[model samples]
Target: MQNDLFYQELDQFNLFSEFAEPQHYQPVPNDWFVVITDVVNSTQAIQDGRYRQVNALGVASIVAIMNSIKPLKVPYIFGGDGASVCVPSSVLQQVKQALQATVILAKQQFSLEIRAGVVPVSDIRQLGKDIRVAKFQPKDHFSQAMFDGNGLSAADSLIKQANSQYLIEPVESDSLDNNDLFEGFECRWNEIPSRSKEHIALLVQALPNEQFSSDQIYQIVLMAINGCYGDELAYHPITPKQMSLSSKVADLQNEAKIRSGFVGKLTKYKYIAKLKLLRHVGNYLMKNKVKTDATEWGGYKQRLVENTDFQKFDDMLRMVISGNEEQRVQLENKLKQLQQSGLLAYGIHSAPSALITCMVNDYNHDHVHFLDTTRGGYAMAAKQLKSQLATLKSVE
Candidate 1:
C-alpha cells in the first residue's frame, strides 16, 4: 500500500452520481490516519453571529495541516465548523503538532474550543467498516475528495464521545508560535448575497435498506435537488456578479484579529496593513484585467466559482444551493417522502447569504474555496441530521 501517494494515485471520476457507487471507491490503506477537528458548541456560536470566525477556524485547521505536511497530497473534506484530513503515517506526527497548535490558536484568538482527534484506518477497519475514498474532478485544474462506507461516520462518533481516546487536547499556552501555521488561509470577501430568495445548506445521509442500495437512494436525493433547483449552474451559491471584495478596515483585518497574541501587536498591525494594500492591488488588477505570470486577474472570480466545494460527498451528501421558499419546500417534501419510506435522513437550513473561506497557495492554480450558509451552515444541519438519526435508532 502506498503511503503518501495513496490519494494521488486514485482514478478520478467526473459524474457526481458515480460518487455514490461503491465500485469507484477504494479502501483506505491501513497505514493512513484520519484527523478530525470540530468546534464545540458551534451551533451556539453561530447563533451568536460568529459564523465567520467558526468558518475561519475550520479553514485554519486545514491550512495548518497542509502547510505542515508540505509537498504531500492528502484527501480532506471541509465541514462548515470543522475539517477532516487523511494523511499517511509518515506525516502523522507533524499533522498532530499542527492540529495542537491550531487548538491553542483557536482558543486564544476566537475563544472557540476546538476538539481535534486522530483515528487510524486500521482501527476503522477493526470496527468492520472501511474508509473507502474516491476522487471527484469537476474540472481539469481541481478535484475534491469523496468518502463512502461508514468508517468516517464511525470515526466521528468515537471522537465525539465523552472520553474519546483519539482526542488531541491542547497544551496550556498564552501564545503558540503559529504565525506560519495558517499561511494561505483568508476570509476577506464579503458574504455572498443569495441570487435566489435564499441560500440553503442541506445534509442528507442514506440509510441501509434491503430493497435499494445506498447509492440508488442518493441518486434519488440528487435528482430531487436538481429537479427542484435546476442544476449546479442555476443553484450554485456564488456567482461572478455577486462576488465582491470588502473595503471595510475590520473586514480586511479579519485574519489579523484571530492572529493576535501569536505575534506582537506591531507585527499584527503591519500584517493588516499589508492585507489592505493587497486588497487594493487585487481590486485594481481584477478591474483592469491585468495579466500576471501567475494568474489572469479577470477570470479569477469565475475560476474560484468553478473550484468551490459547494456540493460534496463524505459519507453524506452536503451542499449549498440558491432557491426560493417554494423550491425548498418542494425539495423538503421529496426528502420527507423518501425518509418516510425508510430511504434517508436529511437536514436543511436557509439564510439570506452564503459564506466563503479560502486557501490560496497559488494564483493560477493550487487554490480551493469552502462555502457555507451565513446563519448556521453545515454544523446546524448536521445537528438536525443527528436528531433524526437518534430518533430513528430509538424506534428501531
Candidate 2:
C-alpha cells in the first residue's frame, strides 16, 4: 500500500457542510482499515475522580499514532472515552505495533486500560455498513476529518467485542518497550470552570428511521440547542476565568506513576518540583506584554481558545457546553419533546469543570486539544441512550 497515495486521493475532496444530508457522503476505499481505541472501565475511573486521566489516555492513543505516521494525514475522530480513525492498509502493521505499546503505556504509566483494535474496510462493507469522508479546515493551523458512515460505528462495536482476536492485549511482561511513542503528549491543563458557572456535557444520536433521516433530526435538535443557550462562543465551556494551570502533585503523581523504589520516590519528587517550575513559567509568560518576552505564551493561549473541540460528528451528535440554569432547562425541555416524538436518542451529564486534552505535534502550530464534560460524560450519555433505544426495540 503506497501511504502517500492515500493522501493524494484525500486531497481531491473539497470541504463539505457538516450538516449536509447523510446520503451525500463519499464511500471510503475498501483497502483502508479502521482503527479504534478506548479505555476499559473508564466510567469507574471517572467515578474515582480520574476523568482527566481518562481523557488524556484517550488523546494519547491518537497522538501516538499520528506522531509515528507524521506528515501523513489520516482520518480520525475523538470520542470522550475513546476514538475511531481510518488508515490505509499499507500502514496497518505499524499502527498496530504503536497501539500495542500505547496499551502498555497507559496501563503502566496511568493504571488505565486502553483497548485498541483494527478492522478492515472490506470486512465492514460485508456487514452492509459504509464510511464516508469530509474535511473540516477550522483554521489554517488545524484540519480534522469528519466521518459520516456506519462503517466506523460498526468497526467500533466489533473492536469492543468480548474476547475478540483483533483487540490488542497487554504484553506478558512489563518490558514491552513503548519506545517513547507518546513523547510530547501533555495533559497539564487544569479543568476549565464554566463562565456561566454551569456546564452540561451533551451527546445525541438520531434514531434510524424510514419516516425521517438522521441528518434531519440532528439539524432540528442542533437548531434548538443553539437557539436556547447560543453557539460555541456564547456558552463555551472554557472561559478565560476557567483557564488555569494546575500544579497539584496528587494528579501528577498518579499520571507519571513514579517507581516504587527509593530512587523512584526521588524521581517522583523531581517531576513534582518540575511542575512547580513550569507553573511559574506559565504565569510569567502569560503576564509578559512584550513580544520578545519569555515565550509567545499569549499567542498559544489564544490558540487554545480558538481550537476548542466543542462539538463534532462521528455518525452521532456530541457536545459539551457551559450554560445557565434557564438555558439548560429550555434545552432539556425540547429534548423531552424530541424523545416523545421519537426522532432521536439523547444522554446528558453535568459537572463543575470541563475537561481539556491536548495533542501537540508542533509547538508553534499544527496542534489541537479536545474538551468534554468531566467523567466520561459523552460515554455515559451514549450508554443511557443505548439502554433507552434497547427498551424501545423490545417493545416494538
Candidate 3:
C-alpha cells in the first residue's frame, strides 16, 4: 500500500515537473512600497546604558501598533531595533495614517520618538540582486549607515536628490535588463558607499516586482523607546585591537544592550516552544494520515520536481506526525511520490517513522527547522515566472 501511494506521488511529481521549466521569472508587482523607521540617537542611548529597557519598550510598541494595523493587510518586517514595511499603493494613505498615529502614541505612551520613511517598489528582481550585493559589500557608506551610521536619516535626502536628477524616472517598458540596471546605478553612485549602491539596486529590483508607477515619497521614521533610540548597531563579542577607542565603546554598549534585549529574553523560551509545536504537529499528521498544509506539501514536491536539494524535506518529517489521518495519508502520499521520483536518497522514509515515535515518546530532538517549505515553493514558482518575464524584457 505504501509503495502504491509512493508511486502515485511520483506520478504527481512528474506532472508538476512538466510545468517546472519556466519557474524562474514570476512577475512581481510594482505597487509595493517600503517604509523605513529608525530611532534617533540610538547609539547615544546605548552608550548611556538604557539599551535594554529601550529595546523592550520599542519592540513592544511596534508590535502593538502592528497588531492594531493588521486589519489593513499590509505586511511588515521587524529588524531588532526598528522596522521596515511594504504596503500596496492603494493603502498608502492608510499606512501613513497608521504610522503617524503610532508615532503620536509612542510619544504619549512611551515618551519615545519615532521617525519613518517610505519608498515605492518598482522591480523586485533588481531588489533581490541588490540585496545580495549589499549583503556582500558591508563596508560601504549606506551599509555603514544602515548598520551603524546615520544613513537612515539621510535616505530621504538622497532620494530627493535622485529625483531632482531624473534618476527616479520610470522605465519605458515593462521589461528591463537587471544587469544593465545594476551597472548603470552602480556607476551613477560610484562615490556613494557600496551599501547605497546596493540600496538603489534593491529599489530597482523592487520596481519590477511590485509594478510601481509614478514617483512616491518614501516615509522614514525614527523611534526612541524608553528614552533610547531603537535602531542602533549590532555588536559583536570580539573587538579588534586596532579599533578606535570610540568604536570599541560603541561596540561594548551595543553588546550590553543585546544581552538584555527582547531577543535575548525570548530566545530560550521560543526555542522550546517551537520544538514542542513541531513535534506535536508532525506526529498528529502521521497518525491521522492526512496531508499537511498544501503550501508545505507543494513546496516539498517542488524541490523534487525542480531537482533541487532535498535537505529541505527533512523538517516536514519532524513536527508533521500529529496531523489528522487525512493529513497523514497526504504526507505519506507525497513522500512516496518523492522516493519514486528518485529524489529521496537514503533514509527519508525511516526518518518520518522515527520522528513520529520520538514525538509520541517526547524524546529530545529540539531542532525545529523554521523555513516554511510552502513559502519556498511559492518563491521558486515566482522565480520561474520572473525568468519568463525577463524574456519579455529582451523583446521590448
Number of the predicted model whose TM-score against the real structure is largest? 1
lDDT of 1 by residue, 50-113 (tens): 8888888888899899999888888899999999888899998889888988898888767889
Ranking by lDDT: 1, 2, 3
Query: Candidate 2 clashing pairs?
Result: none
lDDT of 2 by residue, 128-167 (tens): 9888876666676666666776788789889878888678
Separately for all candidates shown, the number of backbone clashes (residues 3 or more apart, or on different chains) is 0, 0, 82
Candidate 3 Cα lDDT to native: 0.27
User: What is candidate 3's lDDT per residue for 89-190, written digit by digit as tens?
Assistant: 655564555455445433543456655556644532333421100011121210000111112223333344433321222222212221121110000000
Candidate models: Cα lDDT each? 0.87, 0.73, 0.27
Error of 2 at 154 (Å): 1.2
RMSD of each: 1.6, 3.2, 23.5
Instruction: TM-score for candidate 1, please give it.
Output: 0.96
- Residue 350 C-alpha lDDT in model 2: 77
Alpha-carbon runs more than 4 Å astray in model 3: 1-28, 57-65, 68-74, 123-396
True-vs-predicted CA distance for residue 388, candidate 1, Å: 1.2
